[model samples]
Target: MIGRIRGILVEKTPGQALVECSGLGYEVDIPYTTFFHLPDTGQEVTLHTHFAVREDAQSLFGFASRLDRDLFRLLIKVNGVGPKLAAGILSGLDADQFIRCVEARDVNALVKLPGVGKKTAERLLIDMADRIKQLEGQFVPSAGGGSLPEGAVKPVTGSVSDARDEAESALIALGYKPQEAAKAITRVAEEGMSSEDLIRLALRSMIPTK
Candidate 1:
């Protein structure tokens, strides 16, 4: 298992990042939540990573935090979930939010995520509710202010529309139909919203939980 990666960020898109370690460029698949936290191209970035191997293919998935990576591992263990769907779930919500939803039995919020239906949501709640307890020590509040660790670089902000495009592409990559992605984007469209904002708002609008 490739547990971590430290490299220069060569390029980044909504769902992928090209990172060069030594002379080789590694393409790392990442959730949108991780993508949102990426530093600008050409900067040194570090990610907690998981390397998955199958007879047909091999892939590396990266996350901004160890908690996110750990939660992803748990998600893939669900009866009906796989790496892609697990990644999609993390793309829609970070580890903390997802854990909160599971703890609260927020099926409505889970169903709002791309590719998750009611049955899947229920499965996630039942299966993940206990698994999330393992992540308690790793949890970090997203809204709590904190200084960047030494050697960490800040992400660059892009235009609002670019953010929208990024968020829409992420939703579509998570298995949403193009039209559905567009409608969701349109519904939450607002001035000055970053891609992260658009994604969070769009999801909240679609999944109103108790």
Candidate 2:
């Protein structure tokens, strides 16, 4: 139940971030939507988090907004949905977009999300339409953002190949097959695009709106 973390962002990949707080680095799994909001490698960032525990593992899932985090809590309670799938869903669509889809019964939009098939999409619409009512008035900006740390933080630097490699790795981590990730990256990649841009474009290609 670690609800929030404010610290220096040490590292950020498309699916994860390492935040150093009080001299300890916390590895927090994040969705690409949250990833898009991250400041450079060394800045104060605040993430609304949900701590998950099981017999075998523990994980912290972080979100850029309280609404997204709250929606995530409700999503995990849905039948057959778990934290990983819920994270993937948020990566594709933030909470507002997701709520609209559920309200509109947009199965096509949900199905386009990574790892979600038609049956699962329909399930989300039916299951979440009512459960989402609990999240009213909760959309707020994350705290500790737009501020620098006490000391300077060295930025992470990488080459073009590095960006491609990181983007592919991130997609694979999100449950896409290696082949699929590679193909998607190859299809959208261009010279000088950062890993974030590459990942965003690839996901958009996979989950187009029209």
Candidate 3:
């Protein structure tokens, strides 16, 4: 099952992280929310994981917490929902935020998530309403608290242009078109904002909560 991993973070992008465990480097697909909490490269980090196996390909998805990982498992079981879409959903909203939206039947918020349309949002509302119950007794990590240890993220060394480019790439990876990603990053672009900061702000601007 590959339930968890604790290793040195080798490299990371918006959609993936390379973790070195023992002598092996495992490439883990992670949502943006999980990416947000990743420590700087060379620091130790841990993630809850779900290993997916198909006839031709295998993948490992990582999450910031067990709750998020469990929620992802339940999400993929929904009709028409797959691992990628589930990752996109978590990229927009972490497990706790997603649960609240589901409980409130907030279709607007759900629809704002990448790759989720109105129909999919409504389906998620009806489908995940009960599925979230499965996570009731499990641990619910505080927002932005897991996957990264304190003091591990240092100021990233890069120019504003580099930060903007990285943020745009991240949004595009989350299913936003190139134009949309560029516009969002432009709107939130500020001096001294690192790539991670720009990405977080750009996502919030695109997916504002009610």
Model 1 alpha-carbon drift over 4 Å, by segment? 141-155, 160-166, 192-197, 208-210
Model 2, 37-128: lDDT tens per residue? 78877889989999999999999999877777888999999888899999999888767668767888889888877788888888888898
Q: Work out the TM-score per prediction.
A: 0.85, 0.81, 0.88
Q: Give the TM-score of candidate 3.
A: 0.88
The top-ranked prediction according to lDDT is 3
Give the total clashing residue pairs for model 1.
0
> TM-score of the candidate numbered 2?
0.81
Full ranking by lDDT? 3, 2, 1
Cα error, residue 162 of model 2, in Å, equals 3.3
Better of 1 and 2 by TM-score: 1
Q: Which segments of candidate 3 are over 4 A away from where they belong?
A: 137-161
* Backbone collision tally, model 2: 0
Candidate 3 lowest-lDDT run of ten? 147-156
The C-alpha stretches of model 2 lying farther than 4 A from their native spots are 138-161
Superposed on all Cα atoms, the candidates' RMSDs to the truth, in angstroms, are 3.2, 5.7, 3.6
